[model samples]
Target: MKFNKKIFNLSAWITLLIAYVLPYQSQSSDGHSTYLGYPLSFLTINNTPIYKTLFMTESIDIFTLTIDILIVYFVMHFANVYLSKVKLNKGMNKTKDFK
Candidate 1:
């Protein structure tokens, strides 16, 4: 079966959402970070997570999330375009060589 662009676009957006929104124990509880009085991304490096989850982190705003979603979608779309360009066969006269 042939692949379709919409399927890729949808899945790419979902993957981006997971990357930015999926909570990871990237930090520990010794320190604190805020995002409107709630926890945000952490800074995990070693076995001990290094950030507090509450009383120091900011809350999630939907507007910020919407913008992030759009940004992620565009990034994936552009990357797909770039890969397609790279996959094309060049027969001595590639389009990118022209000014």
Candidate 2:
């Protein structure tokens, strides 16, 4: 549960993969607004969804990809920290009981 280098690296790799897989398309079809390449047709505001699924489009939007990567990175980092803290607390409790 600790935030070791291995775990951090693994998460980093996963984040990179996600960013690469979810490409952002800039232009919207038929004057429809798009976030990355997905049409915002579903939303009333005519804005594309922030998250796009794989196999939706071939092109990649660099800007949106970067944003996704950063968001994932931060979330993973925070998760690691939280898990480590919980683990440390559990260990401390176990030692105290033994003593």
Candidate 3:
């Protein structure tokens, strides 16, 4: 089968959107907090009470992001393969009936 750039692009964008949209927040006893998403952490906030001060930080977990992308890609690939096979089988059955 030929490669379709549009499908690839669309899947990649969707995967990224899902990865970023779903986030889990966790806070520690020491006033450290983190926002973890599927395969990566999106934000980290640290609170230090040194004369009333708050610090916020945000970073992307490259490792997890990479893993997330790979996982999504594989899932999409398998789904595409399964769908194509189903379509091909349907087409073949139609041809057999006509013959």
Candidate 4:
């Protein structure tokens, strides 16, 4: 099997989103405590993170992040597919004007 640009770009995008999406420290309590009472599991299925912040197990984060990530992948692919085809239409119109 081979890895490709799509894999890296999507992974990088999610990684950045998580790193930045973490609720701001200003919103958190005093920067010393996690909003949640426990370390969060990145894979938390529900609103558990609404309470803790110790950092959940990587296993959990992985499982939870997967579904969201696959959705992102499909969305990007769909958008690009339409955009690419649209560009061809644009060129056809431009050529028609010249003729």
**lDDT of every model, 2 decimals:** 0.48, 0.52, 0.64, 0.49
* Candidate 3 residue-wise lDDT, 1-99, digit = tens: 556566667666765676547765666566465565555554445554566544424456667666665666666777898998999999999999988
Backbone clashes in each candidate structure, one number apiece? 16, 3, 0, 11
- Displacement of residue 4 (Cα, Å) in model 2 is 9.2
Q: Which residue pairs overlap in candidate 3's backbone?
A: none
What is candidate 1's TM-score against the reference?
A: 0.39
Candidate 3 local distance difference test against the native: 0.64
Per-prediction TM-score, please?
Answer: 0.39, 0.49, 0.65, 0.51
Worst 10 residues of 1 by lDDT: 34-43
Backbone clashes, candidate 3? 0
Query: Which of the two candidates, 1 or 4, achieves a greater lDDT against the reference?
Result: 4
Model 1, C-alpha of 69: deviation from truth (Å): 0.6
Best by TM-score: 3
**Worst-scoring 10-residue span by lDDT in model 4:** 36-45
- Model 4 error, position 6 (Å): 2.4
Q: Write the per-residue lDDT of candidate 2 for residues 1-99, one digit (tens) a residue.
A: 344566556655665554334534444576554333222111112334558543443434556545555556567778878898999999999999998
Error of 3 at 90 (Å): 0.6
Q: Tell me the lDDT of candidate 4.
A: 0.49
Q: Which residue pairs collide in model 2, if any?
A: 24-61, 25-36, 25-37
